[model samples]
Target: MKNYFWNMLINIKNGQMAKKSVIIGPRKNICESFLKILWNEGFISGYKISPQNTRNLEIFLAYTKNGKPVINSLKFLSKPSQRIYYSSKQIWKIDSSKTFIIFSTNLGLKSITECKKNKIGGEPLIVIN
Candidate 1:
């Protein structure tokens, strides 16, 4: 019984030591540009979704080769208004154990602010025109 309990405790501890992941939402061209920065800085190991394919808010989730959590993007439903609703819901789905990054341009400031107000883990990285 003692050995079994110790084994269980070890398993739990290992699970808790898992690295956190990240989520990223790139809603504008400038946001996409900053993504390159994140990638270069090694702050994010990998990323899902692409700016070129953001027509419907369907973004990607990136992970490290070692399976470490990295970054993710928001998905969109039909219609533009649905984007807010879907993005909010997606933000809520973000794992608390992971980090979230939101990339937005000047034009997307309002949207990023709203996301922040909603408790989405994102900050505006300004893009100079």
Candidate 2:
């Protein structure tokens, strides 16, 4: 099956490029968790379930004062065919200060920092810088 979270990422990217204030996507637990991560990391202003249609998600894009998108780059680590999973020990090898990696764990999606702090790891989903 296609990854809806990846499509949501693309929508956010496209929305930023097009200077769109908001991007709409299907409401999904995973996607909502990812959006929450983005918001916590300051990539997006925020997101909410659409009032008109509860099944839709409305994500507010964030931009800089000079009209530049907050999210400048994105890297997808896991694909449907080949998945990437990292243990807490292996996750400690990545030393990136400018980027954050999202990992899907049993408790839901967690960032690299959270994984490291909690001594847990999961599939490396995407890296945003």
Best by TM-score: 2
State the displacement of the C-alpha of residue 2, model 2, in Å, after optimal TM-score superposition. Answer: 6.0
List candidate 2 stretches off by more than 4 Å.
Answer: none
- State model 1's lDDT: 0.38
Q: What lDDT does the true structure give each of the candidates? A: 0.38, 0.88
Any residue pairs clashing in model 1, and if so which? Answer: 23-72, 24-72, 48-60, 48-61, 48-62, 49-60
The TM-scores, one per candidate, come to 0.26, 0.94
Model 2 Cα shift for residue 79 (angstroms): 0.8
- Residue 53 in model 2: shift from native, Å? 0.9
Residue-wise C-alpha lDDT for candidate 1, range 13-49, written one tens digit per residue = 3332344343335344444444445455453454556
Q: What tens-digit string does per-residue lDDT give for candidate 2 at 1-129?
A: 236877888898889889999989889888888888889989999988899999999899999999999988888899777998898999998985867899989888999999999989799888888
Q: For this target, which candidate reaches the highest lDDT against the unseen true structure?
A: 2
